[model samples]
Target: MSAVVDMPGAAHLVLADGVVHLDPEPAVLEAMLEGWALQQRTRFLNWESTIRPRIALVRRLTRFTNEYPWQWDPAEVEAFFDHLRTRRPGRPLAVSTARNYQNDLRLFFDYITDTRYGWPSMCNERFGRAPVQLLHEWNTITHTSEYEGAAERRPLAYDEVQTLFDAADGRVGEIRARRRKGSLAALRDAIVLKTVYAFGLRRQEACGLDLCDLRRNPRVADYGRFGAIFVRYGKASKGGPPKRRSVLTVPEMDWIVGVLDQYVSEVRPAFMPGKHPAFWITERRDRMSLRRLNEAFETARQAADLPPELDLHSLRHSYVTHLIEFGYPEKFVQDQVGHAYASTTAIYSHVSDEYRNRLLRRSLQARHGDLWGQET
Candidate 1:
């Protein structure tokens, strides 16, 4: 009779106490135990609370088990996977989401097989299943296998920006001087919107900035104004050698410093949750969280009569596009945006004419009158 065993240092199923124990190496056992522990810890945590947290944990588990070989009965695994596919609930799961779940399962059981327990060895050999092939079929059905396109999009046009700026300015002015103070909150809101749009900061990055991050300086220098800011890696990133604070350019520095001063001196001090590491605040004096910042952007978007779909991250996309339009190299833009791959940076290379026109002109110049009189 086969039974699962959890011995002092090793854990696996056995046919008897010592019926030829297989995969007895300590390193393998430890690795297997580690994978199990990860699963246990992940399961203990409440995954139902948030989808992001659940996805993150699932990814972590996937990474942990990716090294092991598939050990489960392939047919059993395939059946379970099919169940996951057919399981209906609220919203339909995206193809990407299903693939992610499959990846996690592959890692988990593969590690168990890599442990080389006799039962796993037997199970791996006996299981003849095509889960991976089925996953490919699912992908084909969902059309997710098509090349995921790049996201580099054009920024709002100059006219649009001007319109938004003028509208915000009027609102802020009214809020600042009004006797009834009906729209007095507009002053702080306008400052927030301008700083975000002008600087092209990530919503969280903008929300995360502290007063100390801004180096306020009155001096103007040759390389544009002399103020500076340190762009800290956001919470979404796992802190490591890759993550660090980067220096902002002059214009970005200026926007941040101006907002910092306004928030600190005029707006922040009056609010209860003002002037903390967070720069923006709500009318209730609460430090502006990213969620609040999103809401604020929506409110400002409506007030400015801008497109309803626009969000704060659009500011970052706009920033990258502006740089590209101004003829900055892909590498330079990538560095500014903290992207490691040029392909990732190229997402911002959408059909915005700023840089495209320059390249097109160069191409035309190279031809130089060759086709001037060609028949149509």
Candidate 2:
């Protein structure tokens, strides 16, 4: 059967008759990749941001095997992952990340081998062999646990949070004391860090925030325009637009009202941001770069003597845990964080032992009401 139009497996004939080529093999491989990309775009309806990395991974696999898709052996898949697992001084691949890579690889091979793709026959005709799936359950990782994140990537202790803020503020003082540059930047960082925790935000979500996103909640008129965070760039599902959610300000974290107000009224204008809509502005008067955001956290983390693993994301984790400890309902916390599942919110929560002890005490008091405040 011939390939059809507007189908994922039918891009173009790779090895057409009388087509002279200096590199026939590479041409065939590229054709396969093009077909896969079209499939992802038209059939799967994936965004470029999602498809780009998966395509890059397939090319990376080609280099690892030095063999075409038809020639790829499952053993090569095992060897490749082994190389990745123990390769060099850097940390090994995260279990979740590795599992995703494996899933991507499996899907690529599945595409080529499927009867509808016409690739199996094409490859067999060209190279006397057909492509087959390299990845299998035996060779690939699985999602066995709910929380497979790094141990260090957890909610920071209350004291650690204070120390982090102090370090960021102290940086501003030090810069001004020395008559050095970047005092304003240091000040901006201190406030931004606190804002990030006050509203449970992912990196991109935080980056996407603007002045317009600051909306007033009628219930919390005391907070005025800072009563809620309108997250226009919440994390999305596969091949979907960014999710949107409005996180209402909780009384416990309402301290962020003053911090954000001061930043907008005083500190942000100092950046000379002319008509820039971004809540976090750079010295160049544009939206803050992710690199700069990372640097801001890293500088404070180092100064506070916090663990290297406690990156900016820890602030978000700290937020979830603190909200839980502060007697917020689980559903409210889940909605505030824009988590699609309660399980995901649970994973983010790393409530302190003291909080757990309080929970246990409350539980005991509920079951034994009359025993409370009595001599045993």
Candidate 3:
């Protein structure tokens, strides 16, 4: 008889002569989970944002089922999710969140069950069973709708945009009047908010911008170095690096050129960030964080007294809507936001009723002209 040796700290049952022994140890299981997480980090660009929460979700599920991945079943998954729904009486998970959890579990199981990972093989050799996918299409939530986000989230109206900008600009004067020390920082925050809207940038993308990313557009020489923003950290696909795009300065928003030019020439240098590349910098001369960016927007929004539902992302939505209203092509708008699909771009667009009426009138006029020409 061959004896199985268990590592001291990482003890797990070993198969010998095709006979089953003890249960797999927690240490051995955790090591395998760590390897899976490492693989995910290697493959996904947004892994840093997701890994911790995903690992915690898995651990919670394990605790709920009182079993390891190899012992899990479809019934266990169903029960686990059911428990989640009722875990807090008034705080049930949102439909989209529940679906996301289901998808995350499927991906996790897919990795461990794959023969290349050796998780299934190791389990089968030791415990006479292997991990199988617990969540299936029938059991998971169906993606029946195109836009599953919160109903309250929406683009700001044109007047609301103006009010928000005014609030941001007013913060500078407010600080100065109060003889506060943060007046310069308030000006910087105002410009940052405008830049986010002007470029339709995500919070992280805006935070990631550097001074050098502002480029001169050959087609628009008047705008000079402020003609286009070279976005280096656009939203990424599932397992891809951050996308890149050049957002050209449009004629409607060309006023940003002067604002940026003045800031770069005078205001920014006051921060005394020697050789720092970040366009948005803190008083410490370090790069501005995403949290600070959100705080800036929230401050402005509250001052403007806009809807509570409106957040920093609403600026991006407003950019999409206003561009469509300005009669830019759908394809052009889609590229501006780095959306993988045109449909995703469409979801962001919420044009005004007046703009829709104008489009309808133009269509009718063109139809009438064609009819008159046919009669002739």
Q: TM-score per candidate, in order?
A: 0.60, 0.93, 0.85
TM-score of 3: 0.85
> What is the lDDT of every predicted structure here?
0.54, 0.86, 0.84
Model 3 is weakest, by summed lDDT over 10 consecutive residues, at 7-16
In every candidate, how many clashes are there? 3, 0, 0
Candidate 1's C-alpha runs over 4 A off are 1-52, 55-154, 173-185, 216-226, 235-242, 250-261, 272-275, 283-286, 362-376
User: How many backbone collisions does model 2 have?
Assistant: 0
For candidate 3, lDDT tens digit of each residue in 1-376? 2232332211122222343335544744685567667767666636567776788888999899888889888998999889988999966667899998998889888877766656676778667898898888789999999988878889999899999999999999999999989999989999999988988899989999999999999998999999999999887777777889998888988988998998899889999989999998899999999999999999999999999889999999999999999999999999888888999999999999999988887787788764543545
lDDT of 2 by residue, 185-265 (tens): 899999988988888788888889998999999987999999998999888887677899998888888889999999989
lDDT at 25, model 1: 37
Clashing pairs in 3: none
How high a TM-score does candidate 1 get?
A: 0.60
As for candidate 1, its clashing pairs are 69-110, 152-347, 152-348
